[model samples]
Target: MANIKSAKKRILVNRTKAERNKAIKSGVKTAVKKVNAAIEANDKAAAASALVAATTTIDKAASKGVYHKNTASRKVSRLAQAVNKMA
Candidate 1:
């Protein structure tokens, strides 16, 4: 429990930010799963489309500070590699 007024406000703000970050992370996971699912199904077209969506979501998450830029780039690269390997 925060006693001071400012501290209490900070707690509330932190909670809100945490929830927002959690949602962004969840979305990123879902997008990545979609890409993986398409890849597993051996559907090149679907996988390509899913990769696009995943890349966009990952880039956005990185820009928003939910993920580090290099980390996001690595993820995108790996997913792209997997999709390319399907060929």
Candidate 2:
């Protein structure tokens, strides 16, 4: 649909970026789920470990621009709180 060469290149670049962002987003969700699962199972040790992993993943995602900084901080904070409550 892009007749201009620059427009076509931009479209291609955007598609690649979208795919990468999608993968990062999926990873973020998986990490969060791991933490939640650990919490629900009442495994304090596992939850703490998962929380650490989730926080790292979220921080990376935010740094990569897949998630907003505030959103990532909020998620990490809530996950940490949940893990703490299990203690």
Candidate 3:
């Protein structure tokens, strides 16, 4: 428990931000998993489409501060590479 009023407000604000971050992370993970599943199934078309969606999701997460821009770019790059390698 935080004694100071400001401390209590900070705790609440922090919790809210954490939840938002968690949701964004979850969406990103789900998007990545979808791409992986498509790759594993050897569905090239599906994988390509999934990669686009995943890239968008990852970029949004990075823009929202859930991930660094370079980190997001790397993730998108790897996924795109895997999809391209399938070609």
Ranking by TM-score: 3, 1, 2
Ranking by lDDT: 3, 1, 2
Better of 2 and 3 by lDDT: 3
Error of 1 at 69 (Å): 0.5
**What is the C-alpha RMSD, rounded to one decimal, of candidate 2?**
0.8
Model 1 pairs in collision: none
Cα-lDDT of candidate 1: 0.96
Which runs of model 3 end up more than 4 angstroms from their true locations?
A: none
TM-score of each: 0.97, 0.96, 0.97
How would you encode candidate 1's per-residue C-alpha lDDT over 1-87 as one tens digit per residue?
Answer: 879999999999999999999999999999999999999999999999999999999999999999999999999999999999996
Candidate 3: deviation at residue 64, Å? Answer: 0.5
Model 2 bad stretches (over 4 Å): none
Highest-scoring model, TM-score: 3
Compose the digit string of candidate 3's lDDT tens values, residues 5-87: 99999999999999999999999999999999999999999999999999999999999999999999999999999999895
Clashes of 2: 0
Model 2 over residues 1-87: C-alpha lDDT tens digits?
989999999999999999999999999999999999999999999998898899999999999999999999999999998888885
Q: For candidate 2, what is the TM-score?
A: 0.96
- Most accurate candidate by lDDT: 3
